[model samples]
Target: MDMLDFGSPRQTYDIRVEYSLLYECALGIGAFTWDEVHDKLDIGQAQVLQIKRQMSEALRREVSLAGLHHTWRSVLFLIHRCPYLPSTTQEKHLPVFMDWLKEIKDSIRTEAAPYLGASYQAPLAAALAGNALDMQKLLDEHHENPVIYQNLQYLFAVSAEQLLDHIKRLVEGWYEEVVSRDRNVVATLEQSAAQTSALSQNVSHEKLIHTVTRGGEFVAEPGVTTLWLIPQVSYRPFTIRNHLPGYAVYYYPVDPDAQTGLDKNRLISNIAAKHKAVGDVLRVRLLELLAASSRSLAELAQAIGASKPSTHHHLLLLRTAGLVHVDGGVYGLNVDEVLALGEELCRLLKLDGVKAAQETSQGR
Candidate 1:
């Protein structure tokens, strides 16, 4: 067997920022969590609980029936491939999105096939055919140790048509019950998209991704022709990454204050926050440890000789300052941001001075 090359030439791909209400809705649904990690979310536990309580029973039932509470990431596979006009209203696109899902139901399994291991062909074929016995046999053959197979068990058990219907209902219900009422969220998303799109035009792909994701790095991957940077609010402070056949999607968190109109004080405060985040000896040590390698919360806490809560607090500050990032339950230092701190500070200070001079001239 030949090993596949994962690298692609830089010129082969372009990055763009996109706005989609349906995509945001999908992400918002995924962000709903009841675990201890809910504290890490921008919405926080109280709001999440409120959102759950406010949901209609029918919508709640659909979400529960489809196991969306835990398996919501699966919906992104379909969302990434769905054909819809960019920045269109969700109401207009929901029906079209559902129709497209139904249309592709027969071949839906193929979208996920590439991500699975080489041994997945038999089970994937069985899944597509809705053959329970064959799927069981393949699962036994593989010993079912593959996490992807476990994650997608529901898809294998039902026909694509049935699975998509469940998805359609869950998404539509989420929109009607939760998304529709939050008109301000759509405006925020549009503003975020506009801000990011403008920045993308002015910056390199690397810089744009780092700035938007607050510390993410996007390495070129084979076969990906475009990188979609979709701004999202529901999962603020965390970025969700996904890949399709020809594109890479990053549903990155939007800066809440970016759309709130910038002022000199706000700019200065933002710069100060970054400095303040690194002002502590313990925090600096944490960064040193992360610089060496990615570490889990427990590992980081143990290494720094601090309680988990204290370490989590320090990490939260570092993360907010764009100096750290957690992926796959491990925290890694964003070395690029750390190295460019001086340059970033100077850039912001110069902009602040320019803005102040303009304000003085305008007599604001």
Candidate 2:
């Protein structure tokens, strides 16, 4: 994999920022913790708790019926497959999204499965369960299993409208309350987009990525052509990265002017947090355990032979330091953040022995 260096031939990347209510709703209703949201955004504790409650109730009533994973899978599919047409009203995007789902269902039903093997449906089902967004690729990769096909077909029929309506309600009801008041969400995004566009025009892809990704990273490899810089209000202080075969998206946190006070001290504080997080023996062991596979809090505690509260304390520190992430109630290490910490340390110390000394002297 080739790293995109700061000095390179002008390879232009289309950088744009947009607000998605459905995307926010999807993430809000998914595996993310409300604590994470509160940690990053300027939202009140009571409001955060209320939003969490609303999300829980909505998921239980609507999304859970279709299986939360399946619903999220659909959400990802919608994001990746559906063309986000330019519109002032966010709800206008829903019809196109629904149409895409309908098309996928229609193709699977009418069009014969492409594979000739014993069971394409099994592979297809596994792919769907695995959150494979591409319908054709799912068909091509695995022999069709009737069970898988039927389950998906049923899911589409039963849950598609429910999922859309659920998103619609959340967007209208919850997202509005959280973001609509005095929040120039679109203006913030437009500013970010314009700034990004100008920066990209002048800077290399590598520098552009480093600036926007915060503590996170963007890997540019062969066939990874396009990059999306989407700003969101819900998932704050953390940039969620998603990659398909051809493209990748970085859902950046929308930090308003008031919350941007930490900019001057964020790097130093983050470095301190990272070092402190890894300085613990328990946290190191926890990372070792999570390296293999994601685990629940109970499993982590049991593996570490520590009490749940004790284990959670260490995990909280790691999470606060951006060394770990929770997905679907399971904790996983942010390998990129881990690697970036090492790079940051090296950048601080490894450049020159004399330079480090000179910086210390200059500070004095």
User: Against the true structure, what is every candidate's RMSD?
Assistant: 15.8, 15.6
Instruction: Itemize residue pairs with steric clashes in candidate 2.
Output: 119-143, 119-144, 120-143, 120-144, 120-145, 121-143, 121-144, 121-145, 122-145
Q: State every prediction's TM-score relative to the real structure.
A: 0.60, 0.47
Clashes of 1: 0
Candidate 1 residue-wise lDDT at 114: 31
**For residue 36, what is the lDDT in candidate 2?**
43
Which window of 10 residues has the lowest lDDT sum in candidate 2? 108-117
lDDT of 2 by residue, 1-364 (tens): 9888788675555555555555665555443333445645544454354343324244445545334323443454355455544543665655565555556553432121222233445555454344455445653443265423433554434433454565445434434433343234445555666676677788767787787766565666555668877766556666777655456677776645634544325455657768998998999999999899999999999999999999999987787566777656688877767778877766655667767788999995
Which residue pairs overlap in candidate 1's backbone?
A: none
Candidate 2 regions with alpha-carbon error over 4 angstroms: 1-17, 31-45, 53-60, 63-67, 87-91, 94-183, 258-364
In model 2, the Cα lDDT at residue 61 comes to: 52
Count steric clashes of candidate 2. 9
Candidate 1 whole-model C-alpha lDDT, 0 to 1 = 0.72
- What TM value does model 2 have? 0.47
